[model samples]
Target: MSFALKYRPSNFKDLLGQEVLVRVLHNAFNLKKIPESILLTGTSGVGKTTAARIISMCLNCTFGPTSDPCNTCQNCTSIKNFNHPDVIEIDAASNTSIEDVKVILENSRYMPISSKFKVYIIDEVHMLSNSAFNALLKVLEEPAPYVKFILATTEVKKIPVTIISRCQRFDFRRIPTDKLVNHLKVIAKKENVSFDEESIKLIAYNADGSIRNALSLLEQAAIYSNKTLSEKITKEMLGYVSRYTLLEIIEPLVIGNTVEAINKFEEACNSYNPIIILDNMLQIIYEICYFSITKKDPSIFNDNIITHVKNEKILSPTFLSRIWQVLFKGIQEVKSSSCIKQTANMLIIRLCYLSSLPSPKQIIDKIQGNTKTDNNRKALLELLKSNNMQDLYNQIYESDLEVTNYNNGTLNIKTNQVLPKDFHRNLLNFFYNLTNKTWNISIDQNFDISKSSNSCYNKSLDPTVCNILQEFDGAKVINIENIKKEQ
Candidate 1:
């Protein structure tokens, strides 16, 4: 019993985070502007109940608001034990009917039996139904001078605006990582518990903005490991997959290995939660982006992982963002899927194929370097006549589409930029034979270039291929003309 409640923060000064709220509340009390009712809104375990108790102690104590309560006084002792005659802690969830509320109200009119003010705390007040809320609204709207109401709720949305408006609301934010870690360290020392900083951070991350949740997870982890906390122990306790496995999954997607990537994902299915896998990928991408943009180590995030885990920071921000887009879509797909593994595998395949894609710069640069000149055009015309489809595909894929006119056994090639010799040969062969004409490839900044033949070509190659060729060349297609005079 002592262990369960031992670490509860005893006063506002003891509370970590929420400095503004604490300071405001203190000022309100000091100035005697304490409202007749107050709403404490936030997620559970961040000291709402404890704060309520502390306030009760402060208001009724013989010597008060000096950082320490006179716990020996009758009012302080009763409130401490939560059995004060003047202070009532009601579980609004369990007794939410109009009759229960009416009974409390009847008692409210009479005033405090012993303390300065009659205080009523309704926990999970949002759980009260509409009828119950209506019944309680009368007392909430207008209260006696000596009566005070305190309402706490996790789901503030469920509480009607009418109820919210009547109370002075204070929102408790999630405790920060450093604050929580230090608090945990202090508690552990007093309790003779053993743990490391990394293990504590893992617990904090799992808590997800709830200090109470953090403490609860710490208690559970500590018990499992006999008060000794380590990364391995915490991972096992929480059923979390290691960073290495996540990196392995990312490696295949980055390098364009669809089969191997999907296989690795299958191998880790039992060991990993798909949602968590997606979350890890997001964290990894953020780390990479941070490293790329800021030249900082992603490992020092200080919230989750501690030591720099890997050097996957080599990935660029744009690439990381693209990968994240694929992953974000994949996670959404897997969530509604009846067969999660199959959906995840399909998504992994899609992710791998993304790496094979060329950026706009690459395509534009290739086209610039591989324009067909007089010598190149003649060489390419020879390849065209010889009928080399493979060479044709390679050259077309590699080059920008500038050569617009192909007619009657001669290749007219045009470009303001020079073309690659190999590219010239490949395109010359493919176009001349396919059109039954010598290819005419021309280059001129003034001439409107033809639409990307490779882009149009790839539409037939990969189903997911989307041609964004216009972005690279800073030009648009005027026309595509292929003419063969009667041969």
Candidate 2:
């Protein structure tokens, strides 16, 4: 038997991660207050059908309506084996019609052949058609005391509220990670299989909280590794991408190394699934941005991710956000495309291209740098004015000079007047003494000040003026262009 079927929970105590459902049902059965109809709802493989079967055994066991049922008893064994005349199991997905529901309603009226209660366990009950639901509703409203209904569905939204009102509802939760790992460990020990804990954790992580998925993955890994589940073999067998592999792929792409990124992706695709690769890439992007914003360590382990994230260049919100968007969109395209490899290669190219592109902040600053340049200009004037260099300060401040270049302590001044001899050299020395920063000062005597950088006087209007204009409908700021535009 497959591990899924072999390790299926047979009783309330055996069920994991659903304390409320188990406790409620256990109490009800022990007190003999079992509801006529029970509704179990949750995601698949979380023990809805299994719980339904266990309920049947609990009610019909020879020990009679107890919280715990003896598996050796004929009633419990028959129910477990799914061959009991009193216990009926139906796949509602296949039998979702009024006629099928009518047959069940008709059969439910008759007394049990041997057991005390007749149990009907319907799986995927939400798939029943509207007419079928309406038919089932009447029976649920007035179910016979000897007849019990246990309906299970992944989609509780599809169930009618009227039908839901009549049944006692229990929502089962997904099995937790620690519990799943322990469960898998117990199974491996029972089977006399040698396995590492990391291999079991990998299976659990990929299972997405589904116990059945975890067990099935373990089964595949065990067979592939010959009952010895090593982390390396399990990762290869499952085609799961690790954090380290993701770091390798992302580091190149973030650094704008298109060729290296593509080569790494090609290598990864040979081993891992394309979707898993995309998912891991997206996860890395998210983690980097998260750590950048929160200023927290990405992980406890000193793995490749920690070192890669410490690069600081790729930790920018601009890079991480852009790459995340490109990779996220690429995932959808790859899913639809017949040639995933080609599409994925294009995705890598697009990612590197985006990385090379300037950030909005960088572009805006390069264009104007208005706010930053004003600070430098103000500081230079303050130094010249306060240090008793009245003649030079007046010459500079009073002259019709145009700043052709002002970058990082370098200043090039052009004026429509003759400069004093050794003025540039003296100013450089004085500027260094004032700020302790070496400067490159150049001048073009007898030059027009018209061809110069932006005028500090022609400032843009308050940004909120536009906001105020937009806030009130039909509000207009007349001659808006003339207000902002200077020829």
TM agreement with the true structure for every prediction: 0.67, 0.70
Q: Note the clash tally of each candidate.
A: 25, 0
Candidate whose lDDT is highest: 2
Q: What is the TM-score of candidate 2?
A: 0.70
lDDT (CA) for every model shown?
A: 0.72, 0.82
Query: Against the hidden true structure, what lDDT does model 2 obtain?
Result: 0.82
For model 2, residues 121-145, the per-residue Cα lDDT tens digits are 9999999999999999999988888
Candidate 2, after superposition: displacement of residue 344 in Å? 2.6
Candidate 1, residues 27-100, lDDT tens digits: the string is: 87778787788899888877788877777777777675434566788888788777899889999889988888
Model 1 collision count: 25
lDDT of 1 at 246: 75
Clash pairs, candidate 2, are none
